[model samples]
Target: MSTDLPTRRAPNWLGAASAGLAVAAIVGEGFAIGIASDGGWGQATVLAWLVIVLTAAAFFGGLVATVVGLGRGAGMAAMVLGLVGNPLVLIWLLGALGTS
Candidate 1:
């Protein structure tokens, strides 16, 4: 007699969530840039906070998905986006602060 074992697949939702959050972070950063260009320090600061929060969420979510073996590619992409975006946001904030 021959027996077959079922293979387990990781949940795709985690990957999807991570990617979505990363995209949101990018959008938030764009808004922050616009606010900064307009010399709206208060608004820009608020938007910067939004960007930071979104990037953090994406990073943690991606890390969890990756460590859990759930959709490595999507998780890796999200993590990369978060890593790159976070530093850029910080630089923008620093420049804004210096100009103000």
Candidate 2:
């Protein structure tokens, strides 16, 4: 008889890729795409860009942690933090733009 041992989480390279793609999307959508549009952009748009940048950074950091053999939970935590930060950034951007 044979039994399988429990496996650790997959390398989760996707998490890193996810982070990179997210960054590209943000830059493409908010800065490049918006600026290239007919109407000019605003402070809110800039703020949205910032959020995406931060999220990208967090995802990279999480990837590093995972590569260093840190627990998957910690890596996931960092990703979650970025996810939480995203909406708040949008809200702040909206309020700031409105007041300006």
Candidate 3:
């Protein structure tokens, strides 16, 4: 008789990676904000695009982590910490761009 059963949660490393990606997304947003504020390369469309990409990745990644790795808590943290902060960052980014 087999005592070990398959686990429902993803591997520890994957959860950790998800968490890291979430954090990195926020860092990227900070860089984007800095640039948007004329603190760095102003009017850098490429960097703006990069930030948008990272934000999308974070949101999707966080969704996966939340669904498959929620047992580890990293997924939930990513959802709560990363997802919550992202919208405001995006709004601020847009405002800085004078889009809204």
Selected candidate, larger TM-score, 1 vs 3: 1
- Deviation (Å) of 34 in candidate 3: 1.8
Q: Cα lDDT of all candidates, in order?
A: 0.82, 0.60, 0.63
Among these predicted structures, which one has the highest TM-score? 1
Ranking by lDDT: 1, 3, 2
- Per-residue alpha-carbon lDDT of candidate 2 for residues 1-100, written as tens digits (9 for 90 to 100): 6698888765655455555544554554466445547555675567567667777676667666656745455666666656645645657878988994
What local lDDT score does residue 21 receive in model 2, on the 0 to 100 scale?
49
Tell me how many residue pairs clash in candidate 2: 0
TM match of model 1 to true structure:
0.78
- Residue 27 local lDDT, model 3: 74
Off by over 4 Å in 2: 1-41, 70-72, 83-100
Location of the lowest summed lDDT over 10 successive residues in candidate 1: 83-92
TM-scores for the candidates: 0.78, 0.38, 0.58
